[model samples]
Target: MKYIVKLNFEVDGSVDKPDVIGAIFGQTENLFGQEFDLRELQDKGRLGRIIVDIKNKGGKIEGYIEIPSNLDRVETVLIASMVESVEKVGPYNAKFELKEIEDVRAEKLKKIIDRAKEILTTWTKEKNLDIKEVINEISGAVKTGEIIEFGPERLPAGPDVYSDPNLIIVEGRADIINLLRYGYKNTVAVEGASGKIPHSVVELSKSKKTVIAFLDGDHGGDMILKDLINANVKIDFVARAPVGREVEELTGKEIAKSLSNMVPFSQYLKKQQESTISVQPRVESVITEAKEQQAVQVIEQPRKEIEIKIPSTVMEEIKKLPGTLEGIIFDETWNPVERVQVRDIISKLETITNGNASFIIFDGVITQRLLELAASKNVKLVVGVRIGGINKKPENVKILTLADVIGP
Candidate 1:
């Protein structure tokens, strides 16, 4: 049926369902014409049987009426109006009110759409490999280097950890294995059954040329860094996976990028201080300009560093850019819009057509010529490893050195 015309009815005296049904047919007959008659429509098979549900209430009969129809909406509603005009049923006064003409096909269509969505969801879940399966497949495909038990604690480590001049310290055994897959053999895990830093790892840190504490990107990583320092591990640099990510779960490209972005240990500590409201002046005195220049040799830290207002994301990018010698352009939202070599910054700035470049972060010296070009392009800030001897500084363009971004 295309439509169901429904309504409620009341009779002054007792009546049965058939009596009310008869009254509707008798009253609405020939109201408009034979074509608009309910009985005629039912005879022609365009209308279905009329259903009446009645009950006794307060010594009077009150019930509902439903008439199924395959006629068009205009014809169905006209039939409903004719039924509502009925005034008597078998010598008893009656009243009928038009309720609604419900379109049956629309409701059925809605249910069909809902069922289709459910089927599609179940089919997708059954046909596709889940995230864990995909990760396992990728992990199994990698040909990783062999791991070895190193030192007295029998820590998980790569073969070259003892002989390599540089060392990388990670959190767990899986982290060590993941690094080994990326050709990084100078790796060791600090985690053991005792959850303490092994004496051999501490001694190796002191002897290695550069010991980088490569850790996860969560609060646990922060705690481990503190424990390493408390245990007197001589760390030279620090690298972390992207926020909320673990070292073991990172892909090869992610591992390379995180290693390339490693920052000096002193600079890392200074950044941690900046996250809080009050920064201790002693932190500035310890990480001196001379020490910071050991890796990137352009910046000069003043006796007292000036604090400037800049986004935290930009500060984070600066900390990662010391030894990489690369440049990154950021849009107003602090997103890295473009990245290029430090030497190609001038050419890149000249070709910028979007005018959305708000900050330039590079690992080189900022000269006077760069400042003029930055001002012409309407760039707001320029940050670099150092500031060279500049004859003039543009008022519109603000320049910051690595020391200024971190601390003294």
Candidate 2:
């Protein structure tokens, strides 16, 4: 019973709503006879009023007419056609066009359906979902993706460890992951104290950048620090978690506090030594002299060479990598494990664990510190474009040059 007629009209001169309505009634009268007259239908409540909206612009009026009807479909169509027959309104020559005839009940039903769909979508989302938990899961996945492996041992490390100017060495992969979660990207893990210090870490320390040993607050952390020192890894600073706390479990504020409280490695070591034993004044002098002699000898000695066979595939990769500033790590079976930038090779090595790489071919100079690191990781062969001045070469590691493999 509910029907809406949409009519569009244009008039040559300004006209108001009363003017438009009066014209429709006056023109349509008697044409349909008195039985279907709009005035009689409206008076008896069989039809609603005719509504007109008009706007005057540049001396021309344009607007729409809305007529709600309770008449049958046939009567409604006839009345709409009559409305289009309106040729003049007030003093303006005008033309009316029937835009559409819509069933208001159908539109109301459509709205109900649309609202139901919206409610269902909201309910489904809330059925078994926690907004905070979903966010945490996504964030955790992103953090995990940022972790990478380094060296033959497959040490776990953060991506920024290689790119950042400074580094923080933690005790294990968990500590590295925790630091990464808190937005600390320049972090690597030593894994454990059972094996030698990873060659990647040793070589990285020799780059003369500040390296912090951030360890747990227990006896094990102290042991790890001692082991790193014994292996000749150059640690610049030491940061420790609060007593009874591990690096992996520290809160963000605690982590910041611990790093801020870091002490110089030399100062910390001297303090520890003083607390345990009486020091002779000459001990410092002797240590200083020994360090100076070691530095001098490294510069003066000729690099020793050992005969080692190079695989053809490794040689091919090395050839492709030269001038690219890249390094390729190969597994025990001579398969490529990872390729990294030469500047990041040390940090990359410190991250891998589980004997992930057995050989490394690079387009760079092989330094003494790199040789020691490669040996500690049990990497068997090191191939590069050239060898730098090496004070001493570690056993079990064979160094080769591109000239050595290709035969100058």
Candidate 3:
């Protein structure tokens, strides 16, 4: 069908779905003549079966209706208007309101376009050449000249490992590949055959201007870095993926952020020391004591930063507002009421009826003027990216920063 007319209806008294359907056909009949009659159109195969869904609430019947049509927009609108003119269902008074006229073909076209893109992506992943081969072909370099295998251990690495002044060490081959895709060629994985630090890696680290240990955000990564330290590898800086995340799965933006936020080895060690929980010595055995300490540290340190519990609906709005410089107003039930640019938040607040807006979330700073206006509107909470200078605090309104809601 080319179009589907959708409507909502209410009956003063309880009624069945069949009653509503009968009323739509009986009342709208003869008004538009025989050619436009629903039954006549159905007989000619130009109209599909009328569908009704209804529910009884407190002796009142309310529901939705859908009527498929192959007619043009004007005819489809007329059909909707005829249905909306329905005033009675059985012996009770009723009201029907037009909701929308959905174009079936347009929706199908959108789905087809999405599916085509997905198929193209899957095919490209399956048929594309290896990363090294593709890079070699593009550079017009010999196969052996761009060799990514490094050291006697034959570890997976990028081609510029020897030429680049800086080096980045990761957990496995996949991490190196991920970095290479983002144009970082001085990456090498420390995954040796026996899971030990390779001697070539130590020597290469000593030769580089700066050596950075970029590992995953897990216990295994910590153990690997400890092993590297025990092997006497020269690591000048330390970078880690987000908590519970692996370097191999990070995007280019994430990789760049991790590298840019890297801390000096000494500072990283200090932070780790501060976060570690103290454990009393155990007399059973040294190994037993060490295992207890490791487990205690992991349990004591929470992966996420301190955050407040927010309704999922509110959280979703907060996630989208960042970087958009937009502000959203929510009702007391946490449903979004209005969305406007940050600069227009004051004007939007003025337009809202008092007590209707309960929450305000925005990308910009929370200033005193906003708090005063929000307080007058009886807003319960105001959350912003940051808080600005404020002389007076409102009693009814609770303020919070964006960081107070999201966790790292």
Among these predictions, the greatest TM-score belongs to 1
Identify the runs in model 2 with alpha carbons over 4 angstroms from their true place: 1-138, 277-408
Winner of 1 and 3 under lDDT:
3
All candidates: TM-score: 0.45, 0.35, 0.39
What TM-score would you give candidate 2 relative to the actual structure?
Answer: 0.35
**Residues 143-198, model 3: lDDT tens digits:** 22333889998887889898889999886664665576567888888862223698
Q: Count the backbone clashes (under 3 Å) in each candidate.
A: 0, 16, 0
TM-score of candidate 1 to 2 decimals: 0.45
Candidate ranking under TM-score, highest first, comes to: 1, 3, 2
Instruction: Give me the displacement of residue 325 in model 2, in angstroms.
Output: 36
Better of 1 and 3 by TM-score: 1
lDDT of each: 0.76, 0.76, 0.77
Instruction: List the candidate numbers ranked by lDDT, top first.
Output: 3, 2, 1
| lDDT score, candidate 2 | 0.76
